[model samples]
Each structure stands twice: as structure tokens, then as C-alpha cells.
Target: MFGMADMDPTGGLWNWAASSSLSGERVQGALAGALERTVISLDAEGMDGAVLCDVYHVSGDFPTLIDVYLAPETIAETTAASAVAVRLEVEIILPDDSLNPTRYVLADPAGGLRHVHVDEVETDDGPERRHVRPCTGDDPACAAAPEDKAA
Candidate 1:
């Protein structure tokens, strides 16, 4: 369901998009992030729009360095850091028993991601987790599961 050539910006690298928000707050946040990171070659649309950047490989590869984060400071959160992996973050949000999965299309690195699919998953340790993987195309909300629909 994703079309390349139209999204891959770098021409050779993996294409990815951030997010567009209904509130437009995300648009401003993306712009601010680009500026803070000294991103000089941003798509024309991004200059005026906001992106819902959930995950980023901040270091591209850093140990304990958490290259990707859920709520990046650039987008405004309780903290400040670099953008990390967006893909992995989505998975952290997935449910363990729910077979329902979502799908997302990656935008060209040059154009940036427009929208994405993320699922929140619970963890045994402390909090919840989000993962950024391709969904199965049928996302049945956990509460909507037939077994629990009665509750």
C-alpha cells in the first residue's frame, strides 16, 4: 500500500515520515525541530506544517543512548534530547494479545514522513512500550476484542 519513488527523498536511503496533526501543534513542532537540528534541506510543505514525530534514531546507533524516543523534546515533552528510532517506538505501543495490527507508509527522507502506524504494548518492567512496525492491516482496538466486548 506504500509507493516508493514518490517518497524516498535521499534517493538511496530508507524513506520515512513524521506526522501531520489535526491540531497543527505538531506542524509547528516539526518546524522547530528542523531548525534546532540545523536541517537545511526540508521539503517545502514541512516548512509550513507540523509533524507527529514519535520515534527517531537520534544517534542512528547509540548504546544506552536511546537514539529513538517516544516524545522528543524537539516536539515538546517533559525532557529534551535528540530524535531516535520512530519504527521501534511504534511497536512499544502494541498490545501483546491483540492480533489486530496497523499499517503505515514511510515518506522519503527528503520529504519526511506524513503519517505513521504505532501500537502501544505493555511491559513487565515499568511502563508501556511503543513499536513502529508494519501492521497486519486490521487494527481491532484491544477493548473491542470479542472476548472482552462484553465488559
Candidate 2:
């Protein structure tokens, strides 16, 4: 488990764009269905592993549930402060039946996983969303001696 970061107002950079008029009941139902269907699909593919789930509902807006699977070995080290950095070698299954075979890192100050490439991704049933902050080793924030927070 990771330490929970205070809800950062800028965290929406990594969030799905949800409609503002959705009722709480509707949002809950959709989130439940998405979670069930996704988990089942992943299991059928023999890729069932530990999952990290995040459900966000900032203020009174609609909610979004984001899930990712990270293997134990991938988590390099975690600080007491709940800061974790990991290199994930995996394929991101998009709703459009496309796969992004990219190495991602979970370095969001708000504890979110993000693609290293900053690009718009089309999902199977939603508006395209952009991946935030593409950080490489050369990025000062990603280097050993950090100067300022990059992402």
C-alpha cells in the first residue's frame, strides 16, 4: 500500500473527463460495471495480478475509476513519505482495442500512474484524453538529485 497524498487540485491532469451532470447513483452504477467488466476481461487473458484502483470524485462532479496492475517486483522502493517510483514494462489496453507498449512510471506527487509519452489516447467509449507529464531520466525531476518538482 502507498501513502495517500492530499488531494491536489491539479490532479485532474491524469483524470478522465466525466460529465458534470451525472447523478451520484448513476456514477456509482457505471463505476461498478466498469470495474467488474474490466477485472473479468483481465482475468480471462491470464493477466490477473495485483490491481491498484483509484476512484475520484472531486467536489460534486461525476466520478471516474482508474485501475492499473503493477507487479510486486516492479515497485523499486517506497519512501516513508509514501513516495514511490517504479519502472513499469507493460502494455496499456485502450478501449479502442489498441495497445500502448510503453514503459510508464508512477511518480505523480498525487500518487497517480502516468504514461511517459504525452499524447492523446482514444478510448473505446469516451472522449480522447491526453497523458500528462512525459518525464525521462534526463528530466531533472526524475534524476537522483532533484532540483524542483517537474511534474
Which 10 consecutive positions of candidate 1 have the poorest summed lDDT?
A: 58-67
Q: lDDT tens string, model 1, 1-151?
A: 1232223233222223232111223322443454354221232234322222322222111111111212222242201211222322211111122334433333332333322345434334222223454434245332333443456
lDDT accuracy of residue 56 in candidate 2? 36
Model 2 lDDT per residue over 13-38, tens place: 12222313333344333433433322
Task: Evaluate model 1: give its lDDT.
Answer: 0.28
On a 0 to 1 TM-score scale, where does candidate 1 land against the true structure?
0.21
* Per-model TM against the reference: 0.21, 0.21
